[model samples]
Target: MELSNINWMLGAACLLAGIGLGVLGYHLMNAGARNAQMLRQRLAERDRQLAELRDGVGEHFERLGSLAAALNKEVGEATSRLAVEAPHRPDLAAATATMPEPEEAATTSDDVAAPRDYADGNRGTLSEDFGLKQADGDAPQPPRY
Candidate 1:
């Protein structure tokens, strides 16, 4: 028997339903990918922050060590000076003798360079012309651009 008109209508409806379901499935997959990308971005940001924190901690420890060494040297020097000035006080001399020499400290006062706000001269690190190169004895020229 020949197919009826109602059969074609049913086939068309089924095709439309399949297309709609495929579209929905593709959208869901894309949504999942977007969520995964967001999670990855957050993880990377967290890692960067953790790295910065670690660097900060390392710098803090370095400064702490230097400060401790300087304090130790200063105390030793003070103790020695006090012992010399007050020779009658044998206790002060004993204390000075008991203290370690300043040279024995991990770092000396001369080793730790003090922070300088001003440049040493025209070619110092903080100077504007420090890194710039030009011909010898040449005056400053205007920007090429």
Candidate 2:
């Protein structure tokens, strides 16, 4: 090729390449902006949902507190009424009365007998009785499948 024609071709190729790179860069930047906008919208929606949930929980706690207070008031009134009426009823008198002490014979049963010790029941091999050791000549063989 001629030297001037070669130079012209190189310059045209560089120009084409520069234009392609610029277009690609612009599209990529616009795509990033679109993605950022979408993420911001999702974040705003999540924030709104969280605020609603917080309000709902606050209302629930208020209701629970009121219910507990009412229950306490009702229980106090019932307890006072029971205390006033208990002495007038005959059936409740036995249950409400103080207990009597037992005779001396009942408390001496543990002292009369000594506690007996037993061997542990879970330590031996499966083939032998749990509390007994296996004989040296009589080891159990594994079963065939």
Candidate 3:
């Protein structure tokens, strides 16, 4: 009878241990599942944000392309108008009509020398007239209030 009681006590202890282990295992599995769900949700949100950013960038590039094309068309129209109107100016008409073709003009040295005098003369006069000073020079005294 003593041996039987000892065996029964050991069996009860083992059963209690097994039940505690099972509860612990169940709680661990539940926590892991919750963590996995949270990770999946985060990944989904990130993917959505990336998709939105990609779409926005695509739209921005498309708008830039459209604006560039519009600018090009306007520039072309303006160039045509200038070409048409340039000959109508009385002062410019004679000069334009008498001007040699580009191929003929390229063979002459006159075009290259035309602006030499203009560029050489009064190069520094504008800055002097404007009273502009270089930063390396002595600082001008501040005006008294």
RMSD (Å) of each candidate, 1 decimal: 18.3, 10.4, 12.4
Write down the lDDT that model 1 would get. 0.87
Alpha carbon lDDT at 7, candidate 3: 98
**TM-scores, one per candidate:** 0.49, 0.46, 0.48
In what order do the candidates fall by lDDT, top score first? Answer: 1, 2, 3
Model 3: what TM-score?
A: 0.48
Say which candidate scores most in TM-score.
1
Candidate 3 Cα outliers beyond 4 Å, as residue runs: 1-20, 87-145
Better of 1 and 3 by TM-score: 1
Ten-residue segment with the worst summed lDDT in candidate 1? 101-110
Model 2's alpha-carbon lDDT is 0.85
For residues 1-145, write the lDDT of model 2, one tens digit per residue. Answer: 8999999999999999999999999999999999999999999999999999999999999999999999999999999998888775467667657656567867887579665454445443453475556688977879999
lDDT of each: 0.87, 0.85, 0.84
Which sections of candidate 2 miss by over 4 Å?
1-25, 87-145
